[model samples]
Target: MGNIICSHSLSPLSHSTARCHYLVPTSAYDVFINHRGKDTKQFLASSLYDNLQNRGFRVFLDKSSLRVGQYVPEAITCAIRRAAVHIVILSPNYAESEWCLDELYLLIQTGAPIVPVFWKVRPSEDRMEDENGVYAKDFRKHKKAGKFSTETLEKWRNALRWVSLVEGFISEG
Candidate 1:
């Protein structure tokens, strides 16, 4: 472990919020948030970001870290590469966004420890659905377009555990 860098001690490159799009880590981060733009409401209220930061994990949100006119793929690739853990906020609309799917692929490739937290946005849905229903169409489209791999089920298992962590204990209260 290295000596703690005071907030003022951070060079611009280490700060995720820098104007030049530098990644200065004053401290190591535990999780990187991969979510839909519209799902920010959940992130905000969950206080997950703030809680993680308070616990000393530097969580990066796209709106604050990404710069305008930058290469979207490159930016995300960099962030995912640097992250120690990735948290996929799997809402109904998450897979619908090409960007989030791209991030998922990159995170998989990068082999970052991922925690997929499914936000149960519906009271009716028992299983995943496609664009024709209450969920995003990506999963179904992929299945119909071609045979899918077992890896997807493995990933979903990880996601289910994440959801259980928050929900199981949450409801116990």
Candidate 2:
């Protein structure tokens, strides 16, 4: 096997145990897609979820489940805890939805490595003036402050493999 250089140090990890010492690869994120169910059109337009599934990711999407009223939040929260990556599909309507906002807060506060996919919205300061723009504000904080670097797009593809399973976009039930 080729020598794998640990990102933390120049020295290579001869043993598998040493490889685990540094931060794990971004691929550890089991993708959790946070979008308004009412905006399925936007989500489908991006095809981000499908692309992730095609790359062999276990994607947790609400469309597949036959969830009734009252229990949805619990189920969604459970999914959030299990996710390695949370992909927020931000739109004008997205900012208005309390569910979307609450989910964003949870994801941000949890310190999970987030990969925001801006949809029909630009990342700008004006959009973040109100607390409704919390997601945008957080993005700006990370980007302008140089706290976040432009991560490679390949990392998103690699993260799919961490999912437990991927249900096809359309479910029989």
Q: In terms of lDDT, which candidate is strongest? A: 1
Please name the candidate that would achieve the greatest TM-score relative to the true structure.
1
lDDT of 1 by residue, 60-147 (tens): 7666566687655555556776788887766666655545655665565556677755565531121443235444345566446544
Clashes of each: 5, 1
Please provide, for model 2 over 1-173, each residue's C-alpha lDDT reduced to its tens digit, 9 standing for 90 to 100: 21221122221112132332232232334887776666554445237667888899877676653145524555555565557877766554554344554565555544566666555544542145345464455444434654223441112212222211222232111
Q: How many backbone clashes does candidate 2 have?
A: 1
Per-candidate Cα lDDT values, in order, are: 0.52, 0.47
- Model 1 is weakest, by summed lDDT over 10 consecutive residues, at 3-12
TM-score of 1: 0.56
State residue 138's C-alpha deviation in candidate 2, in Å: 18
- On the 0 to 100 scale, the lDDT of residue 85 in model 1 is 87
User: How does each model score on TM-score?
Assistant: 0.56, 0.52
